[model samples]
Target: MSGSVAFADTTFIRYPRPAAKVDSHLDYVNELLTEALAFSPRKYQLLPSKATMQQGRAVHEMKNGTGEVDLLWSMSTDEREKNLIAIKIPIDKGLLGWRTPFVISENRQMFKAIKTLRDIENYSAGQELDWPDVKILENNGLKVEKANSYEALFSMLEAGRFDYFPRSVMEIWKEQEVHASKNLIISQDIALHYPAAYYFFVAPAKRQFAEDLTNGLEILIRNGQFERLFLKYHQSSIQKAGLKQRTVLELQNPFLNPANMPLSRTELWFKP
Candidate 1:
């Protein structure tokens, strides 16, 4: 039996719940893996794990080769820098072409009081500990709270432990509706922005197989198979909302430059 693709829950930009069970990234991996298997007859598999890393420590453990996973999908550039063993997977244009608003929230009640970074100074900001974004909040003298996971932060918020949290608008939109009566609201001011490229980090031990898989994926994308799959699951409204008047770059061309991939060289952290 072939293994499955490994994934970490992104909850927002990458692994939204609706698409979690049958994500495009997984499809891409599988399609490509099948091609590789046809040619090489490798008994390889794509394992999917629900490991959620909301902090650098968690990322370190996984990237340091201690985790029970062969790949981590939809990781950030900062993560790549931490571990070169991570193989880069192709990201959909939907991810690469957009940036969403950053939001602030707390448990029991959402924090809509602060409008800007400067306004947050009087309030405590809860984020993934040591997250690069915290520096912007801290520069303005805002109290920053670091947590290990989203569950932990939500607990603290519900207990009235923290004042606010920074997160992507998409995450807030989806999660808030589910946790709505739970009192989580987003802010009007945009805090930070990042490209929407999601990736799969392949374990170094399986680099050759991963590279082969990547090549197959590149073929699928060039043939528009990936986009067809993407449209099948795309929610019209959500898709519209996600890509309003934005340039949707097709990641199909082999001649495409690295800059075309929305590649960035900045530190990143999930909302913890």
Candidate 2:
């Protein structure tokens, strides 16, 4: 039976389509899924939808199996893994775990003194309402304020509603560029780190598709195409993050599911 794979159109995942209309991340996953079904008797189509984070998850969770969305790439948690079929391989090579703070440019000096996790605990952080990172930060004894939209979080921080917004190393620079009018600045003094993996999750009813995806990803990893694609998109972002120069404040991810044990799979994660 032929089926379709649907992806959420989010700022984090989807970029402006160039003349070639290739989204490096989306195309990589699509390639894996295409290679996966190549051995099967079925064909699959790729569907793109404009959905926010919450909408994407809700669509994927529909029990009737009639939701318009079929797949999502997000950080995995115990509760989420139980509800959907996760293709446990990390897509970003652990870049999501390397976090840097974003603060109003005027408040840049305030972060210079914050050297440890304890120092950060006294300040409020901002995250999206439905993000798993909120719980991860809260579990580590840091207070976090929630915003309903991605762009609003910057505005909230700018208004001093929150002290800082920690973003992924891969994303901070691009975001700063996008929101430069808000006078946002990235912290040069410290980096926050935890073990987090963003995985592709399929609808519960699509177990066979999940298996096909997993197999295809493994094949890509084996042939080294996975690394090629990751480096192609992220090399500059990683270099600019300057992780080695910053003081790292490591924390535990209480939401990480034990069954996934992402740390044990070194090949699937990026060390930088």
Candidate 3:
């Protein structure tokens, strides 16, 4: 049985950073939250809070702790020991998602000569400090330089201050067209890979509420509604990557269609 969970939206995805309005993982969470309200009981209405800390702030406040959120969803193993309840989710599959790297230019002899991780390892690499990808590269013995800002990396990479700049493919594409880069090149080998998910964190004071939420998730799974949500979003990315579409199955007894779900019963709980 799977658990139902709510998660704070992840701020970053494979998109441009400086854009005033950026698409975030939180957007999907909010959408699911809205839909679940109508299906679940009234007492199960979960709320999301805005992050109070900005970049450079310690992640301590974000970590699960006593008197803090009851269950933090989709956290790493390191975070679970700190106060988060682990809810096993289906993330081991490539279905989790991917974010590729983008470089600033592709013209210089140094850039033209590079195509893979081994090539970049021969020179100084620039990336955001403490980022997961940066840590991965460092652990692999790749010499990487940390940058404070994406803009800084662009400047450094152009000035030959650094050998390469690695960032999310979508973000780099959104900021500058990759084909337009005459002085930089994206690396061929992936710097790192890990399971990332939007998870729920319950304040210790609201333990019961968290349990109820988990129960709701189990109901969704039992009813086969859990998979619909994932597949709906999953198809878009698959198509974008030129992959075949997946078939969705209503794999439960007494299956029901979410689209045709009547408002009568749901209205008693969540009002539109």
Candidate topping lDDT: 2
Q: Which ten residues in a row have the lowest lDDT in candidate 3?
A: 246-255
Writing each residue's lDDT as its tens digit, candidate 1 over 89-208 gives 444432322323323343323333433445445667676664544553455456878776555665566566676665543344454555555555554433334334455556555566
Task: Order the candidates by lDDT, highest first.
Answer: 2, 1, 3
The best candidate by TM-score is: 2
The TM-score obtained by model 3 is 0.53
In candidate 1, how many Å is residue 13 off? 24
TM-score winner between 2 and 3, please give it.
2
Alpha carbon lDDT of each predicted model? 0.45, 0.73, 0.41
Q: Clashes in each model (backbone N, CA, C under 3 Å)?
A: 7, 0, 20
Between the candidate structures 1 and 3, which one is better when assessed by TM-score?
Answer: 1
Candidate 2, residues 1-272: lDDT per residue as tens digits?
A: 12223223211112112211222255555665556555543445555544433633453443236554567777778777777777878888878889999988888787677778998788899998878899899999999999876767878998999988999977776677767688688978889999888788777777666676677778778888878877876788889888898889999998885556666778878876
What residue runs in model 3 are displaced by over 4 Å at the alpha carbon? 1-21, 36-59, 62-75, 90-97, 105-119, 123-130, 147-198, 203-205, 222-224, 242-272
Per-residue lDDT tens digits of candidate 3, residues 1-272? 12332323211111112211333234544554445444544334343323322222223333323221223333233333234343333311223223334454453344444345455567766876634445545655578888775456666777777666644322344334433444555544433233333344444445555465566655665675665665554445433432122111111112112232222432112110
Once model 3 is optimally superposed onto the true structure by TM-score, how far is the C-alpha of residue 98 displaced, in angstroms?
3.5
